[model samples]
Target: MGSTVNMQKQTDKVNLFETQMTMPPTSEKGSSGNVPEDDPSFNPFGFVTDNPSSRSAIQLPETPAEDGNVGQMLYRTEDKGREFGSTIKSGKLRWFVRETGSKESRRGTVVFLHGAPTQSFSYRTVMSEMSEFGFHCYAPDWIGFGFSDKPQPGYGFNYTEKEYHEAFDKLLDTLEINSPFFLVVQGFLVGTYGLTWALKNPSKIEKIAILNTPLTVSSPVPGLFKQLRIPLFGEFTCQNAILAERFIEGGSPYVLKNEKADVYRLPYLSSGGPGFALLETAKKINFGDTLGQIANGFSSGSWDKPTLLAWGIADKYLSQSIAEEFEKQNPQNVKLQLIEGAGHLPQEDWPEKVVAALRSFF
Candidate 1:
């Protein structure tokens, strides 16, 4: 969700944390590089920034008051979300999670997984609305994003697909989410990781709901991600504070209000952890490889779980046709619900419609 903004303005922004660490070498592939040997992260091709910036702790500062209206204290920027959330210790990572409804709720359990450059914050309204329907809902910011612990890559946690899946599994086990539960996944890299996770553990999933994530090889990679794959450029892209705002607005027909936009920029402004985490993740994923796995894994015969394509027709990144094509492959189990006015981040662009669709489908 990182955006393209002037470097000067970004530096002028207030510093949120005062932390430091030794850089790490390249994680998986391309361990050899011609870059200077003095670089803390030795590999020449590593996405490690020339100089890692300061970052704040996992705890957030005082909440901003909700002066406007859209109901339910949107985006979890206020006290409603602060006191409602708690940190869960899962292995070496600490996950910041937002819970709604009691764990014993009868309707069923729903685990919400958000995509990169964003956090569980996007699911604030959807989870809130869904909880009122008597379902237990939990949305955790993925490792290295949001209020969750952002471990340095090659440190305790690497941002590889395998690592993400493993971390997520541990988190689920820690939360005692053993019962087959409904899974809602959206966005890129980590978002698609959610789908791949479900594919690997089909027995653990009751039903699957997909948002505007890359489902096929045809799904386009946004410029932000593509740009972040570049050597020097990727480092700069990770530091941008308005990544979420630019990503959402770039694909939508409307602009985000100041209030809503702040929620998205809050993390990036406060620390360099989330942004650097995104950079490492972007560099690790081979879109073609991942998309191929998603397309073929969820194809008709292999996938038996009930699926919902609650897609946003207005998504400039992945068009409505992607959903239509996916539905055709699994006609019996996959249901496509096209949301007319929503765009790339439908949960943020049009949550009411997303909630309604989830209500009917879940």
Candidate 2:
């Protein structure tokens, strides 16, 4: 009887996916300046930095380690044909992806974007739930994070915004995930980058949701963000397991058990000890400059696509007011909702709220 009920629910989810894909765009209004032009001077990601040192790739198998802890067990569940662990090459870089769901039903895809420090692993719960609901999901670890390649400053791997953008584009191109799909972005930094991409390729995106992310420059940068960007201190913190664990717990609000936190810690201490790469990415972040440009772009930009701002009130890094203000500035096609009791990592803290928001918003 239990199996029967589960099967019935799966069928219902498949039907729901069919309904969602058939839905029309939020507005017939055409996009204008918001679409990024391929000008020679236009850099989608803010800046470029060069590392004169050489670099090498860590050859991670296309699979999650079977010997992982509880967090890994929870996040890495295989769903027959729906489960995936793969890699896509973008120039000299290789991206790591933990994806699920299927295109067999013809329902659209859903892309999950994670923030700094944390890799695509942040979206494991959300991706699992969404995939179960019958939407194809793709969560890729950024070039420097997760199982992806990590280029040391010694190896000419100066992590830059432009490199991130290019690698992301190349990953999607390699996987052939076009627009008309849902995009869920977490954290302020990744949200700024993802939003810029979405605004440029609005036609490809059916809907977008920003969660616990910095959409406006209203809030001050969290101390954790600042600390992680400090010269030697930042590198030391990222490399030190104890400090890194403390950093994750401080931002999470809810306590993370040692075992679970270890799962989150794995990528940082992976094959080449790439924790410093995260620090490199963090150092390049200038939220004041980045958020200002985003706010300005969205204000005058023409984007009629449906957008949802789902913020976790307990998030210490980003204030809830940023979400509210963002919706106010672009209320015409935007909606703001707060998730109670969840922090910066809402999906980990409150997966149900995150899942429900995605269900309704899309």
Candidate 3:
């Protein structure tokens, strides 16, 4: 209760959108490559580009594909608003939730938390496959990312570490998404945030699996992520469809298929772009301080829960030594698995291997 109140007070401390970020000056400047910006169906807020010259951004599909993939579903007002009424009632966000597997044949529930700039769409294939193995999987696009509500600055969303953790906790409570579920956390801030939450609510978590997320600052920030935190350049890259596409491609050792890449792009481009949300989220990342807190949280407490550190050897952003040392320190219950030929987004690059790792862990 104290934490909840503290988080609320923190939210009141800042004006999220005081920094002025304007849309590209002209329709030609607005388009991301060959993707038409002036189309009648175009949503300026949907996909974006910082590249003033039409040469740089990737050309995204004019419209989303019609065929529905497995576990693809939108959050209707009645279904998602049941417990967390305020989030839905605000009308600023209609969060997306993806699920696979049935309770009847469920082995266990696995909650997947994606990192910044990416939603649950990152785990679509992984979740569907895990369902075949008898595990019920759930992945939600965190408030700002994915199809969730992207509240601009003046509205209430602060996009802080505390805010995200609180929002996720409230979502679980409101939905009655009980514990005894495995938590798979991706990226740095998210990994730390989820770890802290699991430590406090140990009863709910079955195990913890971390992928390409550094728990300390010894690892340098990747160039792409670093750019996201820079002022004008960061904002430009964050909203640019080409840069985003390149980041995704570079993060993985495997080539991403066209359709899958589009899925990742749609959310950021949705509604004239979630640039404000992206910038707010990037500003919260303080590796030196935050990583220390996470390391302390893991070290000071007795983490008897099983933890798996799956590192991608080819990852340019996160260091492999950190993962090695983490497992070295906790040999009793922690296991470090190096995923070869995989980069940051292992789920996308090597879903088969990722699935195998989960199955073995369970």
Would you estimate the TM-scores of all the predictions? 0.78, 0.73, 0.72
**How accurate locally, in lDDT, is each candidate?**
0.76, 0.64, 0.62
Residue-wise C-alpha lDDT for candidate 3, range 124-146, written one tens digit per residue: 67888898999888787777766
Which ranges in model 1 have alpha carbons more than 4 Å from their true place?
1-83
Model 3 TM-score, 2 decimals: 0.72
lDDT of 1 at 179: 86
For this target, which candidate reaches the highest lDDT against the unseen true structure? Answer: 1
Ranking, TM-score, top scorer first: 1, 2, 3
Q: How well is each residue in 120-159 modelled by candidate 1, as lDDT tens digits?
A: 8878878888899989999999998878899888888889
Ranking by lDDT: 1, 2, 3
Q: What is the RMSD, in Å, between candidate 1 and the native fold over all Cα? A: 13.8
Over 4 Å off, model 3 = 1-93
| Candidate whose TM-score is highest | 1
